[model samples]
Target: MTTTTQERPTGTTTEHVDVLIVGAGISGIGAAHHLKERFPGRSFVILDALDARGGTWWTHRYPGVRSDSDLFTFGYRFKPWRGASIATSEEILSYLDEVIADDGLAERIRYRHRVTTASWSSAEHRWTVEGTREDTGESVRLTTDFLWMCQGYYDHDRPYRPQWPGLDRFGGAVVHPQQWPADLETTGKRVVVIGSGATAATLVPALADTAAHVTMLQRSPTFFFARPKTHELAETLRALDVPDDWTHEILRRAYIAEGDEITRMSFEQPDELRELLIESMRPQLPEGFDIDKHFNPSYRPWQQRLALLPDGDMFTAIREGKASVVTDTVDTFTETGIRTSSGEELAADVVVTATGFDLSVFGGVSFAVDGQPVDFPSRVTWRGLMISGVPNMAYVFGYFRASWTLRADLVSEFVCRLLARMQERGATTVVPTLRPQDADMPLRPWAVPENFNSGYVMRSADRMFKQGDREPWIHLREYAEERTALPALDLDDDSLVYR
Candidate 1:
């Protein structure tokens, strides 16, 4: 590959490349695979802030960390997940490592490279990217024809922790799920896990094994679903001697179809579906357990991401008296525990703020056009991948309703196809710009509030780009629809300005 070096007064090292991918996690690795397979002639580099691969998996090391979604869909479409359907964090990281080694992606990855700013130059038909090395504290610059953002939406540096009165007075060690300390001890301690989402759900069961007593403190209840660790389809296929790839496709399609059916059912007959879910889980809990109080959610299914308990592990722990759930708001933190809004006091040796995530768009990287800062919220989203005014750039944002990698893999394939089209036409730039006719289209929230009620997403709604009401612009959440539309999307569409 041909390269050029540019010198500047700021003492930053600069290099020219064809593509710059901003992440080394599942998305970036998959994107690199697509690039190498589909467009080998182009030179690209994967930059990661951390010194290692597995973006979120590498950072989050809390107990009982695992994927809520099944691995058949969460795993890359090209790669067959030959392990359990619900995989652990370590297992997921190992899968990523295997992919990296098998695909020889390690050669192209630049670790500890944190992207700080990206400025697009229309005249030059490239982006001037600036980043810092987390290890060496050296500034580096790269000018590339295209910028691919697979950095994900959540901020790893900050976890969403709500302000609690008298928190400082609490003598016990307080922790957040994001920055789990390696040396922290939980064995034989009374741990209080605050939050009702997936993290809290996973932690309570796992912590109960070692902790003297584990309490799940929740302000509101969330709908929970328990799935077996193994999939029957996978087992049957393996027994039938089906090829890994073939079995993967069969299972992937089946899982997608099932999820689609559930989504439809939840929207169509919410009450019936809610009752069915409650009844299904009722048998797993102890008799006379308050199903309506602790298991039922106010919002309909799929309103927020559903919590998945692998192999009914959480319920089993609860029934065994190793764990318990407390439904009440925290009025204040006492010296040794918490005071509840219901005038109840709970004693604890440790408190875990499993609050949630601090959401970010474009991974908190500032974008500029021709030296002018770009206002992300002012721009409309183009097909959930690219911002309308952003040129030659695309973000790999996965679906909340389905496996994240399903959408990510599709985005990679679509980008490669689009790049090929651009190369064939000898075009240097392609930007998704709203046509004059698209002015009056109704603007929709990135995540429609009625459908999604996640705290992090709702809190950062104003900072995200809006989606349109029509096709080619509307960000569809269904993998079935996107899988068809994205691969077959027209490169010469009026919404896309190709040069």
Candidate 2:
């Protein structure tokens, strides 16, 4: 790898590196480790739009912000998460901090530097990345041989806020979970959390402890799976004097097995699964609680992502009269609180919009190939990592049904393998291209409409890449299947162009 440091008249510096990994999130940090392990000779840098390292964990510091999945499965394969099964934002951020410090990645992270546009040059076999520094608004440019997008699929700058009528007239402070204030005064305040997704589920229980009352206002219900905060397997392994890494691997596998079973049962026996979930949660509530109205969703299980309710905290809060669920539509926002369509007015000191995320593919970055804009909707995803027709680019997209890092680890491994093969063949560029028959293959939205029905996904599925029905074209969300298939995938397949 060669480095070129040039001083422009505008006081901007243009640097060249072998790889440019965007976003210093869990995926980007993992990608850095993999690159360093596999291709030590290569020079790379991680660019993050935020000033901090942990992406989502750093951004979302709201009450009860934590991972929905277990830490073992969500963590990197190379590292063992020696913490509770479900970790908080602080724990997750600290884990990432350890990863960065241990791997000497702190010096490599370009924090506050956001990449706004990426254009590929076929002749030079490089990508020209352009962006502005968040703090200074100064232009920054990076030329790299490859681009790895670990920025995630959602926009962190803004949360998805619906245009509720009379929202402006509300007397209370309206806040979104994404842009949570550090010194948010919720104590003794009647808080109304809007939406029934993961954020809402988490915020309601947490705010209930101190707030006068927490009301989860949802138009529709979401399927929630109760999980224990602790894991017996880890404790048992510790008693056996097993190494942390060994114990972590075992727990990770166990979580994967559990997730797989849940996914399978949801697809094959959705009704049975739904009923089982309802029965499990019913006992956690007080007598005469309207389970059907508050917990019952119109869609089947796994249609939308299940909110992992760790240790029945949400249920306990509701049962204790600290928090309550309001299943109704917002007719409008009253001066004091929200007025439901049923004429029930909720009075609140603060209203928290625990709404879904704004889907921003490529971190809202512009892309062009040889001066022509690369239309993402027209492209197909290859193995759920790289986009077809986009040269020397790969993204870390995790499984929706399982842990995020499980698929992230696999994608990093695949990229390393691909890099190794390229080095062996003296190849400078690699891109996934469709064969003649692939053109005939039916093109569906990246997130299949029938498979995934999450509000955030449904809102932005059309702008994303398409996935085909056949091999090398489709992206499977199954970790067990991907683990068996990804490593053995033929690098020389007609779909991939290596040169």
Candidate 3:
């Protein structure tokens, strides 16, 4: 996979390759492996905006930063995860490093090359991608036969922080979990964490170890799944001297099956499932605690992701009087603490806003097709992999209810298969088009609120691509269904117009 650079008349250098991948994170690295394994002759290069690899893992350095999803499923399908079920960010990054080194993917990656724009030319039958080097701040241009977008769907630089009145008057230091300060001291300090998602759950227990007291202030409650860090099946398999590969596969399948059942119960028996989840936490918490006020969520289980509390550590911290929970809205930020709507002033020295992040479409890269600016929301998705009318391009949007890597691996295989088909037909360009039957198909938001309504997804609904109400056009959130459906898709179908 050789790349050639030629000087342009404008005094800029342009690199050319058969495929240009837009990220070097988990998805991008997985895509690279697939390309090398199947299409070894194709020239490809990976461009990433970050200074290093491990997109989210590298960016987030907050206390107790870890994977909410189990590592067995979160890890790439091709690689075996021998670590604990719930892995820290460092462990995950180490695993990713091994994959890059073993597959020789490090050289193919260009870190700090932030893509700014991408333009597709029908006449030239190629895409011209433009960006700047973060290290040198110089413009970089590249052209490719196929553009693969593996950038994950969140803004790493900016976090979604809601404005509260009198925040400017707050005397203590305020921070967001996304951009945790390295030198910030929490030892023996009163800390108040905002939001009740996975980040807050992970932070409370971790901060409580050093902080005088850690309080989790939330606008509402979120469901949490508490279990031991190590999987029982994994231990059993290891005790039986099972091979790492076999154990990985077995545990992966076992978790997926269990998750599928829980997902099904969330819809079919929501009330029962909700009670069971709340009951599971009852025993973990102190006796006579107000579980209903703090643990009960309004939405059904699996409506959004359930935060995993390994070994019920957070509850243990609360029981030990090191941390506590507050279910109320923030009235305003006081000089030394936050004032809640219930007329309670929660004193704190440092505030950590775990209020989540903003979604980024295509890494916020401006795109144009044949000189016309691409309006993503106006276009429809093709099997949730490619957009209709976008030629020679594919993006990875993972499943909301499952481990994100599951969909990433599936998309890589589908893209490879599609590329192979195009090669066999000697086609230079292949674009998703609306077939005769799809002309009148009702278009819906990429993710319907009824199916999965996470805050980020709902907030970015207007900017997301549309999904059709039919097969090969809608985004299937079910991994089990997509595992079979995506591979069985007929590349010769009229929906994909190749020339």
Q: Highest lDDT: which candidate?
A: 3
Clash pairs, candidate 3, are none
Alpha carbon lDDT of each predicted model? 0.90, 0.90, 0.93
**What lDDT does candidate 2 reach at residue 225?**
80
lDDT by residue (1-499, candidate 3, tens digit) is: 6788899998889999999999888899999999999999889999999989999999999999999889899999999999899999999999999999988988899999999999999999999999999999999999999999999999999899999999999999999999999999999999999999989989999999999999999998899889889999999999999999999999999999988888889889999999889989998899888988998888889888898899999999999999999999999999999999999999999999999987898999999999999999999998889999999999998877789899899999999999999989999999999988887899898788888888988898899889988877888569878888888889998889999
Question: Which one wins by lDDT: 1 or 2?
Answer: 2
Misplaced by over 4 Å in model 3 are none
TM-score per model over all chains: 0.98, 0.97, 0.98
Superposing all C-alpha atoms, what RMSD in Å does each candidate have to the true structure?
Answer: 1.3, 1.4, 1.1
lDDT per residue for candidate 1 within 1-499, as digits (tens), equals 6667888787676899899999999899999999888877778999999979999889989998999899999999889989889999999999999999988899889999999999999999999999889999898899999999999889988888999999989999999988999998999999999998999988998899999999999998988889988998899999999999999889888888989888887789888889888988899998888988998988998888889998989899889998888899999999999999999888999999999986787888999999889988878888888888889999898988898899999999889988888889899999998888788988888788787879999998889888888867788567767778788888888898888
Worst 10 residues of 2 by lDDT: 1-10
- Model 2 compared with the native: what TM-score? 0.97
The numbered model that scores best in TM-score is: 3
Ranking 1 against 3 by TM-score, winner: 3
Q: Model 3, residue 162: displacement in angstroms?
A: 0.5
Model 2 Cα lDDT, one tens digit per residue, 165-205: 99999999999999999988999999999999989988989
